[model samples]
Target: MDLGTSLINVALLAMLFVVAVAIIRMRSLFAIVMLAGAYSLLSATWFVVLDAVDVAFTEAAVGAGISTALMLGAMLLTSRTAKSERAILGVVPFLVCVLTGAVLIYATIDLPALGDAASAANSHVGAQYLERVQADTGVPNVVTAVLASYRGFDTLGETCVIFAAGVAVVLLLGFGERSLSARSDKGRSRKESK
Candidate 1:
């Protein structure tokens, strides 16, 4: 990658780190939700910089869009401010996190450098997709072709999973006016019978 792109990536990552710290330090649930959305958008920007436009689009739509909306909807059923509770700093959890991060970093040491043309990813199916996507799928956009045609089943399954999660959240939150009315009716009947 060019120096400019590298700088951009570093800046974005730094901003994400700052946002994460702010999120963890904040007590307001509303602010935390907003920061989480911002985090998703920043991640989407990073994906774009890496030339993963399809992944960026999915992140923006699902992460920044649907996720934020669903969280806000759920927030409507709860207090805006987070409840103050005793903070517990568990040594085991902290140690586990550190060890996991260390292991992940060590694992990347053997991976090929980013954008290496002869890397396994580029040499394997990626090149074939880039070369044959137009003729095979007749889709000009390689990303779209690969996502919609080559990996259609996987994409469809992901979409279904996301849709199911959204539906489940809505149901769990009891968001509709009908459910609220039904709850009120039940409460009234119980009061009258009592």
Candidate 2:
């Protein structure tokens, strides 16, 4: 990538990191939810920078839009502030996370360098796909052709999964609100009778 792209990526990543830290340190559930949405939006921006428009769209819709709305709905049925509790730093979980990250980084060491023309993926299926996509699907955009024609079922499945998650969130929040209101109504009836 060019210097400008690299700089943009660095700035985005830095902002993402800052937002993540703020989310972790935040005590208010509302603020945390907002920050999480911001994090998702930043992630979508980074995906766009990498030229993954479809993935960016999915992230923005699912992460920033639907997830934030669901969280805000759930928050309506719960406390806005987190309960105060003793902070206990767990060493084992931290170590496990570090070890997992280290293993993932180590695994990537065997992967080919970015945009390496000689990489197996670049030399084989990718090259064939690019060469044949126009002929096979009559789509001018390779990414569109691959996603729409080659991986249509996968895309549809992903869409269904996102839809189901949104429905589930709405149902849960609705049920929670109904239960809370029912209890409040019962309490009011009891108080009036007394």
Candidate 1 root-mean-square deviation in Å: 4.8
Summarize candidate 1's per-residue lDDT along 54-84 as a digit string, tens digits: 8899899989998999899889888999877
Candidate 2 error regions (>4 Å): 162-194
Q: Compute the lDDT for candidate 2.
A: 0.91
Cα lDDT, model 2, residue 63:
98
Predicted structure 1: lDDT: 0.92
Question: Highest TM-score: which candidate?
Answer: 1
In model 1, the runs with Cα more than 4 Å from the true position are: 166-175, 179-194
**lDDT score of residue 27 within candidate 1:** 88
Q: Which residue pairs clash in candidate 2?
A: none
Please give the range of 10 consecutive residues that has the lowest summed lDDT in model 1: 169-178
